[model samples]
Target: METFTEASWYEKKENSIVKCTLCPHNCIIKPGKTGICLVRRNIEGILYAENYAVLSALHFDPVEKKPLYHFYPGQGVLSIGTFGCNLKCSFCQNSDISQNGIRDPERKALTDPQEIINEALDIKGNIGIAYTYNEPVIWFEYVRDVAKVAEKAGLKNVMVSNGFINETPGREMIEFTDAFNIDLKGFTEDFYKKHTSSSLEPVKETIKTIHKAGKHLEITNLVIPTLNDDPVVFEKMVEWIALETGENTVLHLSRYYPHFKVSLPPTEVKKLSGFYKIAKKYLKYVYLGNVADPAMGNNTLCPVCNSEVIVRNGYKTWTSGLDQQGKCKNCGLKIIEHI
Candidate 1:
């Protein structure tokens, strides 16, 4: 399979340069240079997705491992990811793949989109495909192609992204992708600019855009110790999510560990508990991830009846409380739609 494909959402400029409009960065490439993503390159004024169909990792994982608590609780999904990321997050956990593009050609394979969909279909209990590990937004053309084939095969497409795409590209994602787990990062613009090398408003806009499209939207926020763990700021973020995306929106509060560049200590369990309390005030479905305590924030309860709707032990999930229609068996309150 060829690794290079003609890129979309770009404009030609004077003097053999191309401006990439796929994301907010709008990187201007000069001849042989690549964009901020280091994946899309401008070769003689023609933009091409240099990492198209080039996969770094592929696996079959539990849907909850996507940290999607509500989408398809107990089902598995075929996950795939390519290298390159639009943002330069200081503490990126997947920096080995995200920060670099197409390293070790012997390990990375260039697979076709239909082949990926075929693998997804062959998985025993797989519900669909998940574009994850690295930021899928940079792999826009490949993701669009794979999702087109997956949709026709009666499979779902889940995108675990940083939500940093431009409005036009984001709308295209909404059309092809079935569900999304967008990383909110933080609430303050200062935190976003300092750590992520991006802005916060665009991420918020992407979240709102997906929610307005009536898509299955979930938000994940990696709570760092000193940076974004302030109670007031965290509360504001939760309030905004509740107001804009509704209380039913699934929120995953993941504990941050020292990785990549940042050397800060792991988040305190007590601190995560406090934030969970604050988030519960506004959001109906809130979960704690990367913590040892399993019984704390892992289970889903009926919002109306206060009964256990879904019990999750690590990645093992059981929907014993919901009936065939995904309504609370105790009170008949609708908890999850697509179970």
Candidate 2:
């Protein structure tokens, strides 16, 4: 098993330094050091992905668990994630793995890429592989390798990302990835900088890039109270999604809970409902997440006739309202695809 694969999208600098261009951070690293993403290291002026083919978590998950409602809803996906992340979000949900890389080096298993594809093949009703859990952008080399094999094996690839990637790598991912659920952390630049230790523009660009490519794209905004829950800002964000990624784009307004560095109260269900209404005004498909209320924002209603098209209870989904073509049975409005 190769522990360190030669990383792509990097340049050697003078005095044994290397510049990593995988993400917008473009970290300049000295020999034996790593970039902002702890997974990629600079060894003797050569960049290597330290977490390449390293499996931290692997499971069979509902595609809705990815919170991707429209892309093959109710189907399962072989989900995998390595350690390390590009941005240091204060309220990171998966801070254990994203903030800290493999704690026990000996316990880290370097599984072959084909092994993952084989597992996906063995799963019943699994649509494909989901590069998720931690930031997939940091695990670029391994993801690309697996995606290539998965594609040849007739498996779809879904990326659950922060979308803070550079143009070259982002474009490369679009070629192989079939769907994306990008976390649009916040609407304002200040919020992104203060809470996420990143910026807003690159994520927006990545969303637009994916949308322009005609790929399945969904946006998830974890609404944090007193941070990004301002109605005006939320509306602007919804408008941006509608204008940039078409009104039909799926938007999931997830409730934020106190986690990691932040100890704020859980996002009010009322706030999520308000934002859901704001989003529904612009986007055709809007759903709320992390809230206990199932009836509020769990189902998909047709834009034309307000008829239930897809009903979801947690991960359990039933498309009873749509025919074989994924259109609303009430008014024949095309609600979703790849059903």
Candidate RMSDs in Å, in order, are 1.3, 1.2
Error of 2 at 205 (Å): 0.7
Model 2 residue 69 distance off true place after TM-score fit, in angstroms: 0.4
Write candidate 2's Cα lDDT for 193-283 as tens digits: 9988889999999999999999999999999889888899999999999999999999999989899999999999988888888898999
Q: Lowest summed lDDT over 10 consecutive residues: which window, candidate 2?
A: 102-111
lDDT of each: 0.92, 0.90
lDDT per residue, candidate 1, 1-339, as tens digits? 244688998999999999999999999999999999888999888998887877888999999999798887899999999889999999999999999876864443545778888888888999999999999999899999999999999999999999999999999999999899999999999999999999999899999999999999999999999988889999999999999999999999999999999999999999999999999999999999999988879999998989998999888999999998999999999888788
Deviation (Å) of 30 in candidate 1? 0.8
Residue 5 lDDT, candidate 1, scale 0-100: 85
Off by over 4 Å in 2: 107-110
By lDDT, the best candidate is 1
Q: What is the lDDT of candidate 1?
A: 0.92
